[model samples]
Target chain A: MVLVALLTGGLFLPQWAMFIVTIAFAKALVALGLMILLRAGLISFGQALYYCLGAYAAGALGRFLGIADIFVQMLAGAAAAGIAAFILGFLLAKYRGIFFGLLSLALSMILYGLLVKNETLGSTDGFNILPSTLFGTRPGPAWVRYAVLASAAVVSLGLALVVHRYLRTPLGRLAPAIKDNEIRVEYMGASARYAVHVIYVVAAVLAGVGGALAATTVGHIDPDMAFWTTSGEFIFITILAGTGSVVAPFAGALIYEIIHTTAYDLSPNTWQLSLGAALLIIIVFLPQGLWSLVSKMSTRYARHP
Target chain B: MRKVLVALAVAAAMPAAHAQSVKIGVVTFLSGPAAAPFGVPAKNSAEFVVEQLNNGQAPAPYSKKGFGGAPLEIVLLDEAGSTTTQVTEFRNLVQRQNVDLIIGYVSSGNCLAIAPVAEELKKLTNFFDCGTPRIFEDASYEYVFRTSPTATMDSVGAALYVKDAKPGVKSIAGLNQNYAWGQDSWGDFEATMKVLVPSLDVKTSQMPKLFAGQYNAEISALLSAKPDVIHSSFWDGDLEAFILQAGPRGLMKQSLTILTTGETAMHKLGKQIPDGTVLGARGPFGPYAPNNQYNKWFHGGFVAKYKDEPNYASYQMAQAFLGVKAAWEKAQDANGGKRPSNEQVAAALKGSTFEGPGGTVKMSIGKGHQAVMETAYGVTKLQGGKLTVTNVKRYPAEKVNPPEGVKSADWIKGGFKAQ
Candidate 1:
C-alpha cells in the first residue's frame, strides 16, 4: 500500500514535491545500503565512492557511448560499483570499528582527489548527463520529471522488497551474530569475513543504483558526490532511519529532504544550524530512530483499542 | 444570494490587485565559505537594488518604478550546496514558489547545471556572477542570459596588463585552484602570454583543490620556480588566505603576482597584500568601475547601506539587476505599457545594451545571450591605511573577449584576431 501510494504520488504532487521525493528516494537507496552495514556492526564512510562511481558511470555512458537509456545506465552504475566493492572488500573486511570507517573515508577521498584532478571529466565542475530516455524513446519535457519519479519509485520499492526478504534469511540474520562476536560465528564454521564481503558488495550495488538515479534526475554529476560530506550525509540518514525495518530508510530520507528544503528556504543563513538541531533532537529523544516511534505508536494503539 | 455575489466579486478582484508586483527568485550563497566575501554582498545589493527600483530612486534611464511600474518582489534562496541540491532548489523556486523570473548564482558549476534546467523550464534566468564561458559555448538557451563577461576577459586582460606593465618579464608560473574557473583562467592567460611573447619561458604550474587554504607546498614550488610573474585566479576566502599565508613567507616579494579576482580581497586583506601586486576585478568593477552617474548612484547607495565600499561581487549583482530591469521595462514598452510575457522579456534582453555601475554591458556574444564588457587591471598601493590600485589599465571588451563564434582558447591560440 505504501509503495502504491508513493508510485501514485507523481500523479498529484507538484513538480517541486515530485523532485524532492525523487531525490529522497534515490538517496534512500544509499541509506538503505548503509543500514545493512550498520546491522553487521560495520560502517563504511566511503559509500560515496560507489555513489560517485555510479553517477560518473551513468554520465560517461551517455557522454561517451551514447546510451541514453536509464536502465542501461543504472545497470552499468551497479555493475561498476559492485565490481569495485568486490575487489576492495578483501582488504576492508579485515578491519573493524574506526579503522574500517577511516579506511572507507580515505578511499572515497582518493576518488574525489582523482576526479578533481581529471580535467577531461570537467575537473571539480563535472559534466552534465543528457536527459534520460525511457528505453529508446524520450519523454516530453513536461512528463520527464514524472517519468523519473516513477522510475525511482519502482526501482527503490523493488529493491527494498528484495532486501526485506534477504534480511529474513539465515545468512542475513548472521549480521547481528558477527556484530556480537565474530569468534563465535567462526566457531560455528561460518566465515564472518565472507559475509562482510558479500554484504559490502550488496551495499555498494544499492548505493550505485541510487547514484545513477540521482545523476539522471539531477541531470548533472560532480566529484563532490564522492566527498566525505556526501558519505557523512548517508551515514546521518542511516542513523536517523535505524536498523528497524527496510521502510525506515525511505521515511528517514523523505523527512530529511523535507527538513533540509524547508530549513534552507526558511533560514538560508542558518540552515546548517537547523539541521544540526534536528539531528540532536532525534538522537536525544528517539535513540532508536524514527522507526521506533512508528512501532511504538502501533503498539500503544493495540494496547488501548 | 447578495452576500455570495459580493464575495465572488472580491475574489475575482484579488488576483488583479496581486498582479501589481513582479516576483523574482534570487539565489545566492548566504552561508558557507563564499558567503562572507561573495554571496552576502550580492544578496545585500539585490535587496538594495530592489528597494531603489521600487521607489524609483535610481539614476536616469533607470528611474522607472520597479519592472516598469510593478513593485519588485524578491524570494531569496541560499546557493550553498552541491549541484544536485541546486537543481532541486531551482525547481522549487520556479514550480513551487511560482517566481516570474530568477536571478543569481556565483559558482560556475551551479550556473552550468542550472542553465539547461532553466531552459527546460522555459523560465527567464539571468546569471549575474559565474565566469564560465562554457555556459554559452557548450550549449545555447533562449531563456538563459548572463550579464557578466566570462573569465576569458579577466585572464586575457591580466596577460595584456603583464605585457604592458612588466615588459621585461621572462618566465611565468601559475598556482590556480583545480576547478573549471581556475583552469580556464590559467589556460587563457598562458595562451595569451604565449601569443604576445613567443620566447616567454613557462615554468611549473601548481593546482591545489579549491578551499585548500594551506598553500605551503604550493608556495615552495612557486618560489623554487622563481618565475618573473606568477598568475592566480583565487577568489573569496581562498584569495585572502593565500595573501595572508604567502605574504609572511616573502613569496609575494619574490615574484610579480597577478590575481585575476584580486579586487575582492584588496580591502579585506589590504595590509597582507604587498605593494606592486597586480589585481583584476574580473571586469571593469569595484576600484576600476567607471565614474559615471549609474556608478555614482550604485556606489553611493551601497556604501550608505553597508558602511563599506562595494566590491566586485556587489558591482556584479547590481549590474545583473539593472540589466534585468532594463530588459523588463523595454519589454513592457514594446507591449504597449502592459506586463509582457517571459518570451517578450527574453527577446528584449537578447543583444541589449545597458548602463551598469561598471559602465556599459553589451549582450554581444553567445548569440546575444552572453554579455561582454571591458576589463581593467592595476597594481596595488597602500594609501591612508587602505589598499588602492595604481597604474590601472583598462582593456576594451573587444580586446580581451573572444570574437563571436570563436572559443576563448581557440581565439587566444589564433592570435586574438578581429580585435
Candidate 2:
C-alpha cells in the first residue's frame, strides 16, 4: 500500500505538483535535523544559519566556482555546513534547553548580518544559483525536476530508515536519556557533550543536504536562509511533527506547503491570518502533531495484530 | 542591539526647532527578508532626492521656492513592516523628532497601521509605495495621499495588455507573495483577465508563504501546469531566484511571462528575461507611450540627474514630492503665501488633481487611503548591451482603476481635497 502511494506520488503528480512536493521534502529534511537536536534536549532556533551555510556553499560553488555537478555541490554544501557546525557545535553543545536555542539563534543572526553587510555575495540582494547539470549533459527542466523529486524520495526514505535504526542503537537511546536526565548520563561516565556535538554535526550535515536540495530546486540562495525567523520555522516544523519519525517532519512539511499555498492563493493579504489560525488549532488540539495521530492508529492496529 | 539603540537615540536627539529645518519623517522596511529589494532602493531614492533638493536644483517644478527657504531634511525611521516595530518607530517619529511631514513605508500592513496615527495627529502623509487596495477602501484621509498607483491599477492594466497582446494565452500559472498587496494584485488581475477574455483558464496558482525564498517545488509544479502564461509578483530575492531558475530552463521561452514588478530587475537581468515578455509598473514609466508633456519634462530631468532613464519607481518618488509641493503651494496660494498648515496641506491633497511625472493623479479616499494612478506596459529587450524595455505603452489610470463608486479600499479611503 505504501509502495502504491509512493509510486502514485511519483507518477501521477503534474510538474508543478511535483515541484511543491520536492519543496516540502526539502523543508522536511531540515525539520528532521531540528527533531534530532530536540530529541537530545537541545532546541535549536538557528538551523537556518546552517541551512544558509549549505545553500551559499552550493550556490557559490555552482555559480562562481563552476561546479555544476549536483552531487559535488550537495557534498560541498554538507561539508561546509558540517565544518561550521563542528566549530559552533563545540561552543553550542555545552549549552542545553533555552540557552542552546538562543545561542543557535544568535549564531544564525550573526551570519545574516554578515551576509547582509557584504555586497560581494550580493549582500542583502542575494546571489542566484547557476543552472545545475546532471551527469555530463544539461538536462531539460522536466528531467532535472524529476531528478529532484527522486533525490528527495531517496534521501527521505534513507533518513527514515537510518533514524528508525538509530532509535534502536545505544547512542540514539542515550540521546533521549540526555534529554530526560543529563546528570544521570554524566553519572554513567558518558560525556554528554561529545554525544551532543556528534548530533549537532549530523544535524548540520542534514540541514546542508536540505539547503543543497533547495538550491538545486530554487536555483537561488539568499540571506533569508540564515535569518532567525527561518530557523524558527524549522523548529516550528519539527514541533509540528512531534518527533515521531523522520517521515513525520516530511508529512508536516507537506501539510504546511499545502496550507500555505492554499491560503496565499485564496487571499495573499489575509493568508497570514489563515496560517496563524491553523497553527493555533494545531497547537490546541493535536499538541503532539499530526504524525502522533497516524502513529496512534498504527499502534492500535499493531497491538491487534 | 547597542548599535541599533544608539542610532535610535541619535534620531531622538534632533533639535525641536520646527521653524528651521523642514523635517520629514520617512518610514520603510530596513530589516527582515523584504529589505533587499524594496527598502534599499526606497532609501537610496529618498537620499538621491534629498541630495537633489539640497543641491539648489529642485528639478524643474520643485524650485527652492517650494521649501520656503528652509532646507528639506529627512529623518529616516525604519518601520520594517512588523506592527511591533512600526508602532515603536511611529511613536518615536511623532513624539521625539516632531517631524513636519511624514513619508515612506512600502508595505501595506505598515501603511495601514501608521495611516491612522497620521490621521489622528493630523500630520501630512505622502505615501510613496504601499499598494494594498484596502488602504483606499475606507473614508479618504484629509492628511494622506499616495503618489504610486494602487495594486489593482497595476494588475488590471497588465491584464488588459495581456488580453490584447497575447490573445492566444489560455492557461495561467501564478506565483505571488503572500501579502495584502500580492492578494489584491492577483485578485484584480485574474478578475480583469476573466472579464476581458471569458475563455481564459487559470491552470495553477501558488501563493507560497511570503519570504519562502526556496521555491523549486513550487517551480516544478508551476512548470508542470504547462500554462501558456505565467504571472508573478515576487519582489527582490524571491523574484531574482525565480527568474534565475526559470529562465535557463526554457520556462521563459515556453511561457508568456507577465512580471508585474519586473522593472526593479529589468536592468540587472535583461538578457535572461525572454523577449515578447509583458512587463508593467505600478505607475507609468517615463518611456511609457501616450507621452504627456509632464513625462517629457520628468524624463529629461531624471536622465540629467541619474544619467539613466527613470524607472517607474524613481518617477513615482518624484511625483510624490511633486504632489506634496503642489498641495503645499495650493494651500499657500489660498492662505496668502505664508506656507500652509498641516490641515490645509492635507485638504489640498485630498480630491485634487495634480500633474505628475506619470501623468495626472487624483486621490479618492477609500479603505486605507490608497493611491490609484496610471500603469505602463512594455516588452523586454537587450539594448546597447543592457536590458532596455521597448514597445512601452501607457494606459490612463481611469481605464484600469475601479469605477468611482466601486467602494474598493483603494478608491474609498483615498481622496484629495484642495483647500
Candidate 3:
C-alpha cells in the first residue's frame, strides 16, 4: 500500500525528485541482489558484469535493432544476463570467500577490457539509446521519464514483495543456515552449492533488470558501466542496508544517494569527509545497518506505549 | 526641461535593469580524477567569467552587463558520477533548477548523453570543452552546440604541425590513455597522417588505462620502437603522471612527443616538461592565447584570482560563456533592446560569430548549430624556467575541421578539405 501510494504521489513531485527516486530504486534493485549474498555470508564483488551486460543489451537493442519497446528491451537485457549467469554460476558456486569474490571481479574486468577495446561500441565514449515507448506509441521526454519512473517503482516494489515472501520458504530460510553451517546443510541431504547457484542466478537477473532500467533512465551506456568501482558501490549499499528485511535495500539506497550527493554538493573540497563520517557512524552505532535502528526504535515505541 | 527629457530618453533606450536574471547552470567535475586539470580550471573560469559579467567588470564585447542587462544567476553542479548520473543532473538543472542556459561537460561521454536530452527538453546547452565530433556527427540537434574544436581538429592539428615543422619525422608512435578521447584522437591522427605524411609509418601504439598513473611498460615499448614522434591526448593528472614517469626514462630524447593538453598542466608540470616536446593546448590557449586587450584582462584576472596560468579548458570555458552572452546581446539587439526569448537566443547564436580568448569561434559550422574554431599548437621549450610552447602554428578552422554536414572520418578519407 505504501509503495503504491508513493508511486502515485511521485507523479506530482518535481521532475528532478522523480528522477532521483527512479534512479535510486533502480540502484536499490541491484543492491537487493547483493543483499542475497550478504544474507548467505557471501559477497560477489563483480555484480557489474551482469549490470553492464544488461545495460549494453538493452542499449544495443534500442540503438541498433530499433526495439524501443521498454518491456522488450529490459526483458532482453535480463534474459541475456540470466543466461550468462546460469552458465557462469556453476563454476562460481564451487568457490567461496575471497576466491569467489576475485573470480567475479575478474569476469567483470574481462568484460570491461573487451568493451573498452571495441571501437564500434563507442570505445570509451559509449553509445546512446533512443527514447523508449509505451506500447506502440513513442513518447516525448516528459512521458518517457514518467514511464521510466513508473517502471522503476513497480518493478522494485514487486521484487521486494516477492523476495519478502521467498524469505519464508525453506529454501530461502536455508540461505542463512548455509552461511552459518554449510556442513550441516550438506548433512541434511541438500547441496548448499545448488542453493547458492540458484540464488546467484536470481541475483544476476535482478542486477540485469536494474542495469537495464538504469540504462533506460540514463539513455546512455558505456564500458564504465562494468568498471569495478561501480560494483564496489553496489556492495557498499548492500552493507549499508543490511539483509535484515526486503524493504531495507530500497531505504538504504535512497539514504545513500542523499548522503553521497549532499556531501558532494555541500563540500566538494572535503566531500569524502562527510560520506566517510556518515558510514563510520552507521557502522559503529548500527553494525547491522539502518534497518536495525529502525527495528529497535519500533520495538522501543511499542514497549513505551 | 531639456536635461530631464534627455535623462528620460537615455533611460528608455536601455532595457530595464529590473529584467529577470537569466539562470545559468555550469556542470563540471567538482571532485574526481578529471577535476584537477580540466574540471577545476573550467569551473574556476566559469566562476570568474560569471562574476565579471554580472558585475560589468569584463573587457569588451563581453563587457555587456550580465547577458543583455539582466543580472546573471549561476548554479554550479558536480558532474562526478556515471553517465546516468550526469544525465539526471542535467535534467535536474534544466527542469528543477530552471536554468535558461547550461554550460558544462568536460567528459565526451557525459556531453553525448546530455546532448539529445537538451533538444528533447528544448533547453539551450553549450558544451565548452568536450572534444568528441560525434556530438554533431552522430546526430543533429537545434538546442545543443559545442563551441570548440573536436578531436579531429586537435589530432589533425598536431599531425599538420609535425608535417610542417618536422618533415623528416617518418615513423610516429602513439601513447594515449585508453578511452573515448584517446581512441578518437589517435584514430584521427593516423587517418590524417595517411594523407598529410604519406611516408609516416606508426611503429607502435600504447593505450594505458585512464588514470592508471603508471606507464613503465608502455613507455618502454615506445622507446624501443625508436619512432621520430610520439602523439598523445592524455590530460589532467594522467598526463602529468605519464610525463613524470616517461620523462625520466629518456622517452623525450628518443622521440618527439606531442601532448594534446600539455599547456594546461604547464603551471604545475613546469620545468619537468622537457624542452622541444610538441604541445597542443587543444587550441591557442595558455600564455600563447589570442593577443588582445580582452585576452590580457582575462589572463591577468585569472592569474590574479587563481595564481596560475589559464589553460585550454579555462579559455574554452570563458569562450563558451562569452558566446552565450554575445548571443543574448545579439538577440536583445534584434528585439529592440528587450530581453530575448530562448528561441531568439538560440537563433541568434546559430549563425553568429564571436571573438574569444582563442581567436574567433564560428558557430555557423555544422549548419549553424555547431561551432568551428581555429586551433594553434607548437613545440615546447623552457623560457626563464617555465614551460612554454614556441614555433606555434595556427590551423585555420576550415583547414582542420570538416565542413558543416561532413562526417569527419569520411571527410578525412575523401581528402582533408573544406569543400
Where model 2 places Cα greater than 4 Å from the true spot, the runs are A1-305, B1-18, B30-33, B54-56, B59-61, B289-310, B365-370, B409-419
**Lowest summed lDDT window (length 10), candidate 2 chain A:** A261-270
Error of 2 at B309 (Å): 5.1
For model 2, residues A158-223, the per-residue Cα lDDT tens digits are 776777787678787789999999999999999899999989998898899888877776655667
**What's the true lDDT of residue A194 in model 3?**
92
lDDT of 1 by residue, B106-156 (tens): 998899899889988999999999988888998889999999999888888
- Order of quality (DockQ): 1, 3, 2
Point out the higher-scoring one by TM-score: 2 or 3: 3
DockQ of each: 0.67, 0.02, 0.59
lDDT of 3 at A210: 87
The sequence of per-residue lDDT tens digits that candidate 2 reaches over residues B73-155 is 87766554224235334544664567889887776656655665566456788778777655555435666777676777777
CA error at residue A232 for candidate 1, angstroms: 0.9
**Clash pairs (backbone) in predicted model 1:** none
TM-score of each: 0.96, 0.56, 0.94
Candidate with best DockQ: 1
Please give, for residues A61-96, the per-residue lDDT of candidate 3 as tens digits: 987788877777779778988999999999999988
Every model's TM-score on chain B: 0.95, 0.85, 0.94
For lDDT, candidate 1 versus 2, the one ahead is 1
TM-score-wise, the better of 1 and 3 is: 1
